[model samples]
Target chain A: MELFIDITLLTFLCITALAITVIRKLFCAVMLAGIFSLLSACLFVSMDAVDVAFTEAAVGTGIATVLMLAALNLSHSREKCPPYQPLLALLVVCTTGAVLVYGTMDLPAFGDATAPIHHHVAPRYIEQSQQEIGPPNFVTSILASYRGYDTLAETVVIFTAGLSVVALLGIRDRRGGQSITTDRSAMKGYLVLRVVTKLLLPFIFLFALYVQFHGDYGPGGGFQAGVIFASGVIIHSLTLGRDRTLKAFPQRFLTILATAGVLLYGGTGLAAMVRGGNFLDYSVLGATALAGQHLGIFLVELGVGVTVFASMTLMYYAFSYRKEA
Target chain B: MDSIPMNVSGHFNYWVAIFLMMTGFYVVISRGNLIKKLIGLNLFSTSVFILYISLGKIHGATAPIASETFHLYSNPLPHVLILTAIVVGVATTAVGLALTARIYEQYGTIEEDEIRIKDESL
Candidate 1:
């Protein structure tokens, strides 16, 4: 039954991919890409990578669609035809595809228990995570506690990316808040959207918090939560205009928020170090190892959530501002 | 027929992933539009995501949710790695889109051929 579902989803995914490539209309292509993301997220769920599915759904389908649409708004709606025949591109792609297929020939059979992946560190994480990390979700335990440094780096990567966007396209209005209103009055036309969004915005934020806190028990974490949270703000901006949203989360405020989140994450590690433990050693933060793990994960996840939310929303602002400039 | 592996049925998922990957790569290289290229890049990374997630699956196992009754769990490492990868992927896309926007602003066109022409003329 699972294989049946997988095959069905894969079939749909293939069709979507083909449609996205064939569609010259960029708007339709963007929408098709959203469908592709939704299909992949379903595949992730079917495979029981619920955390991955959650992130894929939120980032891939939700925020990514919005960002893409915003980008589409800024650029031409239809894709330009290639000036050349693209025969070389086709040759290169076919050769790379052949090489990849040949490389996969030696891989272990699908779902094999004795595969090299399962033989190494994964078994220990699966078996010991409950006792050592005290999280019901081992993915969160591995991500937040066991391999905390990588998560920190991932957060910084996002921060840097967000910063680059800001640097490339300045989000600030130079004429003393005059430019935010450039797009404000236009938003009044969408009264129904504004009202509906106003009502739903609170619930969106509440759910983001739930997903943020529920990582240890279920299939969610800071990344998904942050995107969800930022999506809510983005929806507000989309519906009500950037001026009102910017007022609530000004450029300076968001920059500070992004930096502070990294600080909190790094500070937790520094605190742990000062307590005679290795960097990001959460066991030293609390009396018990489990308690320390819990506290440490919570803090870092919060940090991640804040950073993601600020950076994503700020990038949206930057992109939206650039749409006019 | 003899060249086909013994576990060909089991490897069907990888084949699908590879198909998508190749399609994405083809789109990336063939398309001249910057936005189209970014879309193709997204498709390629997503295919890679599927590849990793498929590899992490364990036959008849559930998600890596620790429990008393269930002993079998899919490999958590790939999922963990992919989670970070997804975030990074989106971040990269955002930056790419931002760059595309800047490119559009400066050149007034996002097609690679046109941009190249404009650059040469300048």
Candidate 2:
């Protein structure tokens, strides 16, 4: 049954990806890309990588589509024809794919338990992670506890990307606050959408918080939560006005929040060091190792959530602001 | 060599991933629009994610969440890696789109060929 579902989803994914390539209208292509991501997320679920599936659905399908649409608003919706034929590109792609397929010939059969990947560190993580990290979700335990340093670096990468966007497209209004009113006219006639969005905003935020804290027990974590929270804000901005949304989460506040999140994660590591442990050694933060691990994971996850939420919102603001100008 | 048998059906997932990767690669190199290139890049990255996740799957295993009934769980390392990759993917996409938007603003066109022509003339 699982294999059936997997094959079906992969087929749909292939169709969506092919459609995106063939479609010239940028809007339709972006929408098809969203479907592609959604189908891939379904595939992830079937593969038993539920945490990855959740993040893929939220970030890949949700935020990416919105960002593409905002970018589309700023640029041309139709693709221009290429001056030259794509024969070279096709040749290169075909050669690379053939080589990769040849490489895969030596790989173990699908779902083979004795595959080499499962032989090394994965066994220890699967067997003793519950005792060492205390998270029922092994992904969360490895992500937040065992491999905390890498997660910290990933958060910093996110921060850097947000900074790059801000640098490229200045978030501040150079013309002062005069342009606020012009951008304030949101979906004026969609009364039903406005009402529905208004009703659902609270639950979206509640779910973000739930996902943030429940990573230890389920298939969600700071990354998914942060995207969800940011999406809620983005939806509000779409239905209501960007100006109103900005009034609540001012650009200055979001910048500070984004920086603060990285600082918070690093500070947790520093605190661990101060307690006579290695950097990011959460086992020393509290009276017991388990307690310290839990505390450390909580703090870092909170940090990740904050940075992602603020960064995504800030990116949206940057893109939409450019569209208006 | 005779003892080993070809198992094409077992490697179907990898074949699908390779197909998707090539499709995205074709789109990226062939398309003239900057936005289209970004979309193709996204497709490529997502396919790589699928490849990694497929590598982690274990037969008869449940998700990595510890449970009383399920003794076996799929490998969690790939999940951790891909989770971070997904967030980073979106971050890079935003950066790419921002650059595309700025390019549109400066050159008044997002078509790569047009932008090159404009650049050469200047």
Candidate 3:
């Protein structure tokens, strides 16, 4: 019965994706993209990834659609295409698709327990993770301790993206604050929304805290929580306008946030270095080896969380503010 | 490579996901519209999500929640990863949307070719 359901949902998702692509109208395509996210989230639920399904439903289908709409409001939604000369492109795409399809034949059975990935490191991580780390959720251990380097690199990626936006658009506002087309009277609708956002802000932040620290006990973690917290700010910016949101988190302060996060990350490494261990060697944080490792990992994860959250939001803001110049 | 579905029956979902992903990629690369590119990017991201979820499946297994009786559950790690990926996806989409809107205001059209032309003319 579940198999039948999976097949149906999968079929619908594919169709929706293709429909979005073929549709000449851009707004329609963006709306269809939201539908696609919802469908994909449902597919995740079917696969028993409930946490993922939840995040997808909220973020992918919800916030992404809003952002896309805001962008669409500023531009034409139609494409300029030639009447012909598309045959060569079609041939190229087909060739690439054929090669990839051929490559999938040798892949392990979908979710096969016999697969080496399941048999080798995964089962060990799942079973022994508790003894190795106090974390009940294996995901937390993998992210914070085992594959710590990847998480760190991911943090750097977010920071770099923000810097790139700053480079592309620069920091100077051409007209300063007086040039916006809309005035204070236009913001009457935002009054109610602002109050609601204020109410939700604390809870959103609390949820982020729960996700970050409680990750060892549950499925939530730093990266996901950072984005959610960032969304709260994003939501405020959307309703209250970029100008008002800037007051809450000034553009100048974002650089400080970014720098602080990087420093925290580097500080952890410095702590490890002082303890006479290799970079990211958590055992060097204190005299007692196990205790030090624990302390070091926690500190590093916290730093990582801050950096990822701040930098990602900083980039988004820069992108939005690029027009001012 | 076989050009036939005769070899695999149950794995059909993967094939469809792949097709959608490739088609989306084609749109992203070939189409000159900004919104179309975002649509294509979303498609590509969804395909990857499907790939992750598919990996976490356990035939005849229950949800990953711990039960009193200790029944089997699907691996919840991929689900957690997907959760983070989904949020990032949404945030990215939001940023992309905001950019497109501003692009329209400045350039009046979302077409990549048009934007290039406008920039060149300026």
TM-score of chain A of each: 0.95, 0.96, 0.85
lDDT of 3 by residue, B56-106 (tens): 787776556544565556765666556556555554554565566667778
TM-score of chain B of 1: 0.93
User: TM-score of chain B, per candidate?
Assistant: 0.93, 0.94, 0.87
**Ranking of predictions according to lDDT:** 2, 1, 3
Ranked by DockQ from best down, the candidates are 2, 1, 3
Error of 3 at A230 (Å): 1.3
lDDT of 3 by residue, A228-297 (tens): 7777777767666776666677767877887777677777777777878877766667766657656766
lDDT of 2 by residue, B29-118 (tens): 999999999999999999999999999999899999999999999999999999999999999999999999999989999999999999
What are the candidates' interface root-mean-square deviations?
A: 1.0, 0.7, 3.2
Cα lDDT, all candidates: 0.89, 0.91, 0.67
lDDT of 3: 0.67
Question: What does the i-RMS of model 2 come to?
Answer: 0.7
The DockQ-derived docking category for candidate 2 is high
TM-score of 3: 0.82
Candidate 2 A-chain TM? 0.96
DockQ of every candidate structure: 0.78, 0.86, 0.43
| Residue A266 of model 3, lDDT score | 73
- Judging by TM-score, tell me the better candidate of 1 and 2: 2
